[model samples]
Target: MPSVIESEVLIRVVEPRDLREVYEVESMSFTGSLTYDFSVFLFYYVTAHDLFLVAEALGRVIGYIIGLIEVRRREILGHVISIAIHPLYRGLGIGSKLLKALEERLTSRGALRIFLEVDVLNKPAISFYRKHGYVISGILKNYYGVSDAYIMVKEVGASLKQF
Candidate 1:
């Protein structure tokens, strides 16, 4: 079931003005090397505007998800470059909303599969992805320098379901 807050939250394409608030969410959600610099967000905004989205509630940016579409070996793939919800909004279904919106956009753009990397130690994230129908396909050692990461993938077709 969706929470009242989730129902109130609006998911939309990210605007240039939302970058700062989006960066704040990113900083709050991650630390050290895991956090992306503001420039990286700007780059994504320029290069993948259609794939960048934000969750707005109460007139502020509460979360954001950035993705990229790539063609490799005759396959169109979607990559979730980054996703983060403000600490206060973590469990209200905002992340799921952001992810669902991204997946829809990617699939429409011909993405046959979606991929993301999560730290091996992040159990909550692993479980979240699993619930969304993603499966761990492999592991990348030293993915985070100080830690490893699990590469998870989900096929984008009739099997995809909404959270």
Candidate 2:
């Protein structure tokens, strides 16, 4: 089977066995005021199957998207809790691919929309998500300890280019 990433780095669902790399990417990609501890990753990254995703390059995972499901008044949605790509692999479409995969999975699971939050100062991420059809729907005041966040949401099943 062809690897998910074109450069032999495959984007795949995060399995229980991939915890070490997942945690490593989680720490390496996220810092400053909002880092989740290893125990939190271990406990929440998987529940029966997976609550996370990773991009693997030559047997090593270099990126991940961690998230959860939500429901309100019987409307279910997939929330893209977090996403990251290794510094070495930035700008190679890895983050976009991983995010697309997550959205695909969530849509297949009957999620009508996927939402996420980005730091107000995260220009690259905001631009990336906007490119992928996620729009800023609202903002959270003091979303983080010091920084505000833009809440973005995208409806699933908008468009699919050829494989």
Candidate 3:
């Protein structure tokens, strides 16, 4: 049940040339210390290119999601490092599309579960994750230096049909 605009967005792996637009989306979606600069995006491109993806529409980058796979106590886990859509494209289902695309990629790579941290004040983001089956597992105090963050997780095992 995606809208026409949502249908037009193409989710694809991140490329070196997409970093500038991705950084612009990040800057528009976040503020102050919460925003990651171009260098961080470049680092992710070099270290975890496979898990990073972008949402392109009309030949321009409109959103992106960054993820990483890690082994924790012998369990392979997927981490959503960051996700953002341009301010003008907020409620068109682009974020959900980006998230689902990343989740499928991670699950295909043997991730048992997926995790992400969101600012406690971001109600829209929290709601978005919740709608996608993520639940708050814990809280990180002062995660943003000025506020707290909620650690959200969703299982991506074989039993989950969405995966």
Q: Model 1, 99-157: lDDT tens per residue?
A: 99999999989998999999999898899889899999999999999899999999986
Error of 3 at 6 (Å): 1.6
User: Residue 61 error for model 2, in Å?
Assistant: 0.7
Question: Model 1 lDDT vs. the true structure?
Answer: 0.91
Candidate 3: where are CA atoms >4 Å away? Answer: 1-4
C-alpha lDDT of residue 68 in model 2: 74
Model 3 clashes, total count: 0
> What lDDT tens digits, residue by residue, belong to model 3 across residues 1-163?
2234888899999998899999999989999999997999999999887889999988889999999999999999999999999888888999999998898888998998999999999999999999999999999999999899999999887755663
- Pairs in clash, predicted candidate 1: none
Top candidate on TM-score is 1
Model 2 lDDT on a 0 to 1 scale: 0.79
Give the better candidate number (2 or 3) by TM-score: 3
Among all windows of 10 consecutive residues in model 3, the one with the lowest summed lDDT is: 1-10
**Candidate 2 local lDDT, 28-68, one digit each (tens):** 87787677777766767555145477888878887888767
